[model samples]
Target: MTVTEELVRKRAEHNEGEICSLEELALHQQDIEKIEFLNKNCKKLRILYLQNNLISRIENINRLKELEYLNLALNNIEIIENLEGCESLKKLELTVNFIGDLTSVENLVNLGTLEELYLIGNPCTDYTGYREYVIATLPQLKVLDGEEIGKSERITAFQNLSKHYKTILKSQEDYFYKRVCRFLSVNVQALEKVQAQQRRETFSKKLEENNGDIEKIAKEFWQEKGPYTPESRTETYEFLRLQKEQESQKAASFEETKPRRKIFFAEDGRPYNINEPKIEFKFYEEIMENEQYFVLDIAAYKNMDTSLIDCDVQTNYVRVTLRNKVFQMALPEEVHPDKSSVQRSRVTGRLLVRMPKVKSSSIIEPQNTKWKRTTGSVEKTESKDKMKGGKSNFLTVGETTASVDWRNITNAEDSRSGDLEMQKRAPVHRRKERENSPSFVDNPDVPPLE
Candidate 1:
C-alpha cells in the first residue's frame, strides 16, 4: 500500500473506501500542523485525506495544485473558500465538518473536472433555500456526497421525495395535498423531482407486481438450502439490501462517474497487474450492471465462498455462491442509512477492487480430491467421459450454438434441472433462456428413446 493509502485505510475507511467506523480514528484534536510539511512538501500528492483532523481552516491547502480528492470530513474546517487554488481537485469529501455557509463552495466553480462531492452529515444539507444556487453553480459536479447532483441526482432525489409525499397525500383526504402542497416547492427542479418521483413509484409498483408473478414460476429458484437462522438470514439480506439501496440511492443521486483505475491485460489471457493499471473499474461496473443487478461484496484478502442479494433500483437482492459441496450467502443488504447526500461520502478517489481472490488450489478442496476424483471419475463411465465434473463447461453468453448445444435436452423433466437452476440463480441482468436447448435428450444423462 502507498503511504497515503495506508494512512486512509488503517484509520478512516475500509479497503473499498467505505467508512468502517468513527471509532477507528476518533480524533479528539486533529493535528493538521504535522501534515502541513507533508501537504506543501508532497508535491506529487494527488489525493489528500485530512478528515477527522482538527483543521479549523483550509487556507493552507490552496497550494496543492495537483490535488484531486481532498477529504476534509469530520474536521473543524469552517470554510470551503480557502480551497480556491486547487483547481485540479476532482473529488472533495466534507461530510461531518460543519461549514455554516455553503457559499464557501462558490470558489470551487474553477474545478471543471470535479465530479463527486460529499456533503453528508452536515446541518447545511437541510437548507433548501440555497440548494438551487449551489446546483445551478456547479455543472460538472455530478455526485454530491452520496447522490447525484444538479442534473440526474437532484432530479431523482426530488422525484423520490415528491412521490413519497404525493402517495401519502393521495391516500389522505382533501386536507392533505392542499395543506402540504406549498411546502413541496414549485421550482422547476422540484417539478423535475416530482416527475422523477412518479417514475420511481411506477417502477416500484411494477417490481412488486413482477415479484409476485415470479414467486409462482420461480418456486424452484427460491433458496431454502442454507444453514441460516431467522435472525442470521434477516441480518444478511438486510445488510445486502441496505447496501444496494445505498448504492442505488447514490447512483440515482449521482451525476459523477466513479474514478477509473489502471488494469493490465496480459498476453496469457489473464490479468497481469501493472504499475499503471490499463483496465478501469467503471467498465467493470457497467458490465456487472448489464449482467447482474446484485454484486457479491467479498473480502479482498480471502476467497469468497458466499454472496448476497441486493437492489437494482431501491429494493434489495440476494447474493449466492456455489462451490465444491457447499453453498452459502455472504452478507445481507438491509442496512439502514442515516446520512444524506448533503452529507459526506464514505470514500474518495480510486480503489483497487480486488476480485474474489480465488486460487486454483482453493478451487479444488481437501487436496486429496484432485487425484482421487480425477482418477476415479475417469473410470466411471464413457458417458461420463464426455461430461465435465458437477460443473459443466459452457460457452460465453454471446458465443455460438456449440456452446449451448448441451441445452438440447428434449424433456424438461429429463435432468434438465441444471439449466433451470442457472435460470433461477442467475442475476436479473444475467438471466438468459437458451433458445437452442432443444429439450429433447438430456446430455447429463442418456435419452430414454436411445
Candidate 2:
C-alpha cells in the first residue's frame, strides 16, 4: 500500500499501539516514486524497508536521520548518493543495483557506523579484485555482500591491492592499443615486432649505463631467468642487438617498396615528416563538467625551449611541434578551436590542452582531410549519386578517393605499447617495504587476533 498518514494511523490502530508511530514502515512493491509524505510523520522511524520498487534515486530520505536499518535492495539506483544525512544507519542493503565505480563505495565509507553493507549483483562486482578493494576501503565492514571479512583476507587484500590495480590498468591499456591498431589499419604482428626491437634497444642502453658490468646485471636477471653467467650475459646482449638491427633493416626494406605519400604541412607552414620519431607521451580525451579536455604529457621533451613550442588546433587535426619532435594527430571529436588553451608545467614538463566542447545543437561538417601525399592532388569530383543527393565532393590524394574518419587516426601515436604481462612483471620498488611491515598473516600457525 502507498505510505500515507492515513494508512500509518490505520496500521497503528489495528496493532493496539504496537505501531504507535510510523517508526517502522514496509512499503515494498508499491511502485511509489516520492516519499515526501513521510517527511514529518516518521520523526521516530528507525527501520525502513523499500525494496522491490522502481526507485531510481536515493533522495528525499534526508529527513530520516534517525533511521538505522535501511533495506533498499532490488531497486534501479545507479549511484550511491544522497545518503549524507544517514549518520545513524548501521545496516544498508543495496544489492541488485547499477553501481559501477569503486569510488561509490568510498563515499559510503564516510558512514562510520556502517557495519553491514550488501552490494552483490552490482556492475562494480565484475571489477578485478572487487571484494578485496571493498574490504580494504571499509575496514569496519564485518559482513560484505553476505560474506564475512576475515582478518587474513583483509591482510591479503591490502597486500595485493596495488598488484591487482596494475592488472586493471594493463587491461585498459591493451583495449586502447587494440582499438588504435584497428583505426590505423596497421598489422598487429608488424607493430609487435617493432615494439620488441624498441624494448631490446632500451635494455641495451640500460646495460651500457651500468658500464657493461656483467656481474651486476646477472644479479638483477637472476630473479627472472635464474642464475646467469658473464658469458651468457654477453651472448644475450649481442643476440638482442643483432635481432634489433635485423628488424630495422626489414622495416626499411618494406618502406622502400611501399609507395610513399606526400608530406602534409601544418597551418603554421612547418612541413610534417611522416618518418619522424613519434612523440613520447600519453593522452586521453574526456568530457568533464560540461567541458571537453584533451590531456597529454610532454615530459620527454622538457629540454626543448618552451617558447619554441607551437600548436595548431583545427576541427579534425591538432599539430604540436617542439623543436625537432612533432606530434600531429586527427582529433577524435569535433571541438571549438577558438576555446582551446595550452599550458606547460616547468617542474614536471607536462602539457595540458583544454578544448571546450561546442554546443550540441551546432551542426559539424566533415572537413577535407589529407594524409601523407602520394603522387599528386587531384581535382574534387562528384558522381551521379553524389550530385543527386548533394553530398560533399570527394578529394583524391594519390590514386584513391575516400572520405577518412580522422577521429580514428588519433590512436596511432600511443607510446605505451608494452605487453600487459611484461608490464605486470615490472619490479615494484615498494613491495619490499610492504613486506617488512607487520601483517595478520605473518604467522600461519597462530589464528588471527581479529
Name the candidate that leads on TM-score: 2
lDDT of 2 by residue, 249-338 (tens): 667878789764445677885545342445566656555665656655555466767887787777656777766556766656667789
RMSD of 1: 34.1
lDDT of 1: 0.46
Per-candidate Cα lDDT values, in order, are: 0.46, 0.66
Q: Which sections of candidate 1 miss by over 4 Å?
A: 1-30, 33-35, 150-450
Instruction: For residues 89-173, write the lDDT of model 1, one tens digit per residue.
Output: 8888887765555656677888887888877765456555334445555767777666665456556555455444443333333
The estimated TM-scores of all candidates read 0.29, 0.35
Worst window of 10 by summed lDDT in candidate 1: 335-344
- Superposed Cα deviation of residue 167, candidate 2 (Å): 6.3
